[model samples]
Target: MMPLIADLRNPAMRDRHWKQLMEEVNKQFDPHADSFTLELVLDLGLEHHQEAIAALSQAAAKELSIEEALSKIENLWETLPLDLAEYKGDYLKLRSVDDVYSALEDNAVALSTMKASRYAVAFLSTLDTWERALSHISETVEMLMNVQRKWMYLESIFVGSEDIRKQLPTESSIFDAVNAAYCKTMRELQDAGTAYKGTMAEGVLDGLNTMDEKLDKIQKSLDEYLETKRQAFPRFYFLSNDDLLEILGQARDPLAVQPHVRKCFEGIKSLEMKEVGKEGRKVHEAVGLNTPDKEQVPLASSVICAGAVEAWLLGIENAMCTTMAQLLFKCYADMKKTKRERWIKEWAGQLSLCSGQVAWTVECTKALHAMSEGQKTAMRQARKKQTTLLTKLCDMVRGNLGALDRKKVVNILTVEVHSRDTLDRMVKANCASVNDFEWLLQLRFYWEAGTDRCLVRQTNTT
Candidate 1:
C-alpha cells in the first residue's frame, strides 16, 4: 500500500497507478474470499480517485460551454460590416462564468446589429404599445412584399424594351405613382419601426390594395402591347421575351442582334457585321457559307474591333444628344420667362376661387336672416334643401383648399423656384447639357428596371 501510494503521488503516472491500486483493494475485499482484519485499513485510495474524476468532469464541461459561447460570438461578429471592424479589438476572451457573461455584455451591439430587424421587433414586444406596433410592422411588411413581388413580375415587361419604354409613357407614369406610394409607405414603416409609432392600419392596407390593382392594370396593358409587337414581327416569337426585348431595345447596336440571328434564320450560324467607315454605319449582309457539299460566295468583307464600335456609337449618341439639347435649351429659355407669370396667375385664380366661396357663404347667411316670418315658413322648406347642397359644396371646397395648402404652390413656384433658379444661373448659367437630355431617354426606366440588371437576374432566378 505504501509503494502504491508513492506511485500515485507521481503526477505523470497518477491515473494508471490510481486505477491499479483501486483494482488491488477491490480484489482483496471480494465477498467469497473475505477475511476480517483485526485493525481496519479504511482504504481512502478509491475515494481520492472518484473525487478527482468528478472534479475533472465538471471543469471539462465548463470549458466546453465557454468554447461554445465563444464560437457563437465569433459567428455573430463576422456578420457585421467591415466598417465596424474596430469592434473586434473590444471582444473579451475570458473563460470563467462571470467572464462569459461580461463577454456577452460587451458584444451586445454586435448581437443586436447582426439581426437588426428581428431585434427591433423583439425589443418592441416588451413595450406597452407592442400590440399596435406589431400590427403596423406586420402590415408594412405585407405591403412592401406585395409591392416588390408585383413590381418584379410587371417590371419584366418594360425592363429591356426600348420600344415599350418610348411608346408607353403611361407605364412610366403608372410606375412613378406606384413608386411614390411605395416610398411613402417605406418612410412611414421606418418611422414606425424606430419610434414604435403607429399609422392607421386601414391606410397601409388600402395602399397595398391600390398598388396591387395598379400592377394588375400594368400587367394587362403590357401583355397586349407585347403580343401586338410579336404578331407584327413573327421572328420576335422565336426569341424569349427577354432576348427579344434586348434585340429590339438595342436596335442601333448591330452586334447585339448577332446572337439571335441563327434562331431567326435557319442554317445561319451568325450574321457577319462590318463597320463601313469611322461614322459607325454598320452594314450587315448574309454571306453564303463555304460548305464542303456546296459552292459559296462572299458579299462584304470589313472588320472592326468592339472598342472602335463602341466609340463610334458614343460619337453618334453625342451628336444626336447635342442637337436635342440645343432645341430643349431654347424652348426652356423661352418658357422660363413666361412660367413664373403663368404660375402666379394660376395660383392667384385658386385664391380667388377660395375667397368667392367665403363670400357666397356670407351671402347665403345674410339671405337666411333677412327672411320675414310669413316668408320664413316657405323659406324653411327651401333652406333645408339648400343646407344639404351647401354641406356637399363646403366639403368639396375644403378638400380643394387642403390639397392646395399641402402643395404650397405659391411658396414653391413664386418663392422657392425663382430664388433657386436665380442662384443656380448666378453660379452656372441656366443651360442644358447633353447629360441632361440623356436622362430623357432613360426616364422610362428611371425606377431602376433598365440599369439594374440584378432585378432581371432575380426574376430569372425566381
Candidate 2:
C-alpha cells in the first residue's frame, strides 16, 4: 500500500475545532462522563452524516430524509424483484426495459469512482465501522488468488473457437435446420396425439401419427450424430508447436529454470591465451547460469500460465489420454474455491430456467389448441407475466440507486410488503449490474424454446 497525502491521526492541526463541537453536543444532552468518548464520536459521525447529505442534492438522495435513512427504508415491497415466485410475463418486460438502462448507467458511475464509498470528516471524532480489519491474512490470500485468476482468464483468450469446435461437428450450418425440424415434428406429433387421442390412423388423423413417429426418429438420429462429432474432436488447433514457446508459454510437466542473484568474479585473462579458454568456461557459469542457489518462482504468476496450459491440454488429452487423467479435472481444481461455489449457484439458477421453459412450452401448445376467447386470454397472460415482472423489477431497482443508503434499502427489503412473493426477493437482491439482472431473467427463459431451461433441467434430474 502507498502512503496517503495526510496522516489520519494528526491531531494538532484540527484539535481545537473537534473539542468545540463535542462541547456543543454535550450541552444539548446531559452527557455522561466516562462515555464522553462515545458521545464525542457520535458528534463526529453526525457531522459526517450532515456533510454528506448537504453535499448531495435532494434529487440525488432520491427524496430520502435523514430520519428515513436512519430508521426506515423506502420500498415498493419487501419482495425482491427477481425472487418473486411468480409473475405475469408481459408485465415484467413492460416494467423492466427502462430500469435496465438506468441501472447500467449507475454501474458505470461505480466503476469510475476514484474514492471508496465511505468518507471521513475533518472534525470526525467517530467510530469507523470498517469491516475486514481483523482478517488481513485472509484478504491478502484473496488478493493473491484474484491476481492469479485474472492472468489465467487472459491466457484463456488465447484459446480460439476453432480449438473448441474440434470436439463439435465440423458443419455448424446443419445444426439450425436440424433443430427446427425436430421442434416442428415434435409439435405436429403432440398436436396430432391431442386431436386423435393416441397414434390412431383413420380419416383426418390417418397417417399423421405415422409421420410424427418417423420425424421423431429423424430427430433422434441427428442427436446421435451430434454425439459422434463430440467423440471425434481433435487434440489441438492449427497453431505451430513452438507457438507456446515463442509466447513464453509454460512447458508441460517440465522443470522450471530458477534465476539466482549471484556476484560474478571480476577478472581479466583474455590476452593470456593460456587461461582464455578456462576463463570463458568459468565466466559462463559465473553469469548466474546453472547456479547452485536458485529462488523458487512466485506461484501466483506461475499458476496462471499453468492454468492456461492445462485448459488447452485438456483439449489435447481428450484426443489422446491413455492414463485417463483428464486435464480439466486438475485445471478446475486450481480455480478459486468460490468459482466452484458459483457453479453450484448456477444450478439453482438453472432450475428456474427449466421450469420457465415447461410453462412456455405448455402455453404455446395451449395457444395452438385453444378454440375460444377465454382460454386464449389465460394462456397468453401466463406467457406474458414473467416478462412484465422482469421489466418492472429492472426499472424499480435502477430508480433506487443512490436514492437511499444501502443499509436502509436492505432493511426495507427485509420488511417491505410485496404484491407477490416471487418478486420480493428479486427486489431485495439489489441489481448490481444490468448483466446480473439480464442473467436472472435469462435463467428462466431460453430464447428459442420460449420455455424455461431451469424447469427442463429439473425434470431431467428427476
Superposed on all Cα atoms, the candidates' RMSDs to the truth, in angstroms, are: 28.9, 39.5
Best model per TM-score? 1
| Candidate 1 Cα lDDT to native | 0.43
- State candidate 2's TM-score: 0.18
Query: How well does candidate 1 score on lDDT at residue 443?
Result: 12
Query: For candidate 2, lDDT tens digit of each residue in 270-368?
Result: 111011135434211111112121211111111111323334234323322321122222222332243322322222222222333444434433433
What is the C-alpha lDDT profile of model 1 across 1-462, one tens digit per residue? 454333333333333333544464453332222342212233434434554444443444443444454456555433321111111242111112233234334555433443343223323333324334434544544455566667755455455455557767798679768866755665554444321232343477678778988988887776676677666656567778667666656665667866765666444445444445445554543332222212232322223323322343333334333433343333333433554334323332222233223322333334334343233433343344445434544444445344443343333333323333332332242223212322122212111234321111111131
Return the TM-score for each candidate structure. Answer: 0.32, 0.18
Report the Cα lDDT for candidate 2: 0.29
